[model samples]
Target: MQVIDAMHKITSHIRNPSKFSKASKLALQLIEAGSVKPGTVSHFFAILEAAMSSPGACNEPSVRADYQALFNAAQGVTECFNQQQKKQFDIWVLHAVVANDLFTDDSFVFSKAVGKIKDAISALPITTVDDDNDEAAALAAVESKSGTTHNNTDDNAQAAASNSLPDDSTHAAASNSREESSDPFGLDGLLEHKSNKSEKAREKTVAALNRKADEDESKRFLKSQREALLKCLEIAARRYRIPWTQTAIDIFAKHAYDNMNRFTMQQRDAITKLWNSIKEQQIRRKQGKSVSGKLDVNAFEYLQEKYSHEKISIRHAVGGGGERRATQWLG
Candidate 1:
């Protein structure tokens, strides 16, 4: 995967660069605390900064795919948490890492811890954010209910007492009856409580609608990002000869497209295996096992057959071409 493009895709959802910076700082703190591996921290900073501050150097080119992918998911999830949640989340992560005995394999420990952190954060309820629309609607509703209820109650009481009796004693009795009938069983209190509940319900509905809109918009944004990244990868692979074959590039590119979020380290492992499969053959050939040091015929044929499709070259696929020509070398 193209590191820069992948970083952009992973972090594109972040509106404020400060949020990303804050997330990176939290990860850095985790690193310092020894909750996770130190190997990937520098890579994290490099790739993260490069993603955030575009045109910035990705100093650590040696960063592994697992680190890149995990950090991306972590950042996205962490950004969802509010300030208090984030602080709690950080503590939980540190604790989880220190107490983690489940993954004794060591090889998969970091990923497991990250997964645990994500699950924990996901379980926490999202804090409701109030907006002006919800507040205004609630205020308007409560005010309308109170105003109409008070005026109607007063008018009904006045009319009931006046229509009942003209004698002083009877008028006093009618007035007492009116008061009792108006809210005989504390219905006034009940009505006010119910009005409050209705206000709350309206607020909740508004919040839910806003949340849904945000989620839909985020999905659309990520979808567009994946499509654009896929197109760019395809264009790059078609015109120029990449170190890896078209099949490998296509496989990963399609994956990046399909799975825009939640990239797994396993995918990276698979790519490495493919790279090694081809690279090993090239090494063998250079050691006099074959004639060429550039391409391994056996490995190429095996992979091409395994991922069979009609190959299209850039020249025939499009009218024009990129200026850079392919130079044969191991990527």
Candidate 2:
């Protein structure tokens, strides 16, 4: 997966150098008070950030898929979410996380503890953001619902009162009356619903087309960032006359991509980790270390495992056809 590209929209929104520093502070407080794992906190942030702007983002299937994918891709660090944390995630994420736990219902005290958080998420934003088409749609919806609906409701109530239907009737008659009132021309209901469905579908297709250009731009931006990081790694290896294969570069490139944000801090961290790996591999070569150390494998795998405490390993081998192969440890 191209991690950098996937995260560009979210990371750009955070707009800060430090990786979720504000959210991390809140998460630490939760950890000290509650008993969920540290990884859970990161998962919470990811769900919240996505939920802020994505429909069905908090749904069980979508949330679970994202959780699993990110856990595997991050090697359990939740690095992507960490890089893209926003202040908005602090409340919505906390509510979602706590609400997911079964133990929250264990006691009355737990009820009071999460009561406020629950209320906070209840009034979730209908549209947290959209720069163009989404914003236009939202505004149109608000105008349609708020402005015209109010006048229509007033007229409908007066008309209903003036033309009150007979109440004394059979139960079957009352049922038929209710159904007729709802449908009016009967086929009017069917046609209205069909038209509504078609309109919504058309709007969605148009919106998707509108977003395609922006998506392309984001991919280009991420590609540039990826190339820049890869070039830095190339320069570092060349300085020491090390053989940095394109395959190995692709491996470490992904790792660096995963942890990177547009922030200066993330860039700095990548460089530090890259340099440390370079130096470590040199020492390993000088000492004629383990099989992993002797081979021209990925430096990122070693760097992340040692410094970040992620459970990770990368294995390189020769295929039956003499092509290079590597096993990736996901989750």
Q: How many clashes in each candidate?
A: 0, 0
Candidate 1 structure, TM-score to reference: 0.26
TM-score per candidate, chains pooled: 0.26, 0.22
Query: Candidate 2 overall Cα lDDT vs. reference?
Result: 0.35
- How displaced is residue 66 in candidate 2, in Å? 29
For candidate 1, lDDT tens digit of each residue in 1-331?
2433433433453223444444444454444454332333223333333332421111123222223333434454454433433443343233222123222234244334334433433333322232223323433545455423422432354345334323335435654665567565666566557546754654554455445434433332332222222222322233213332433433433343334233223222333444444456556646877522232223223322322222212122111221111111101
lDDT of 2 at 133: 38
At residue 29, candidate 1 shows an lDDT of: 49
What do the candidate models score in CA lDDT, each in turn? 0.35, 0.35
- Candidate 1 scores a C-alpha RMSD against the true structure in Å of 23.5
Candidate 2: residue 20 Cα off by (Å): 13
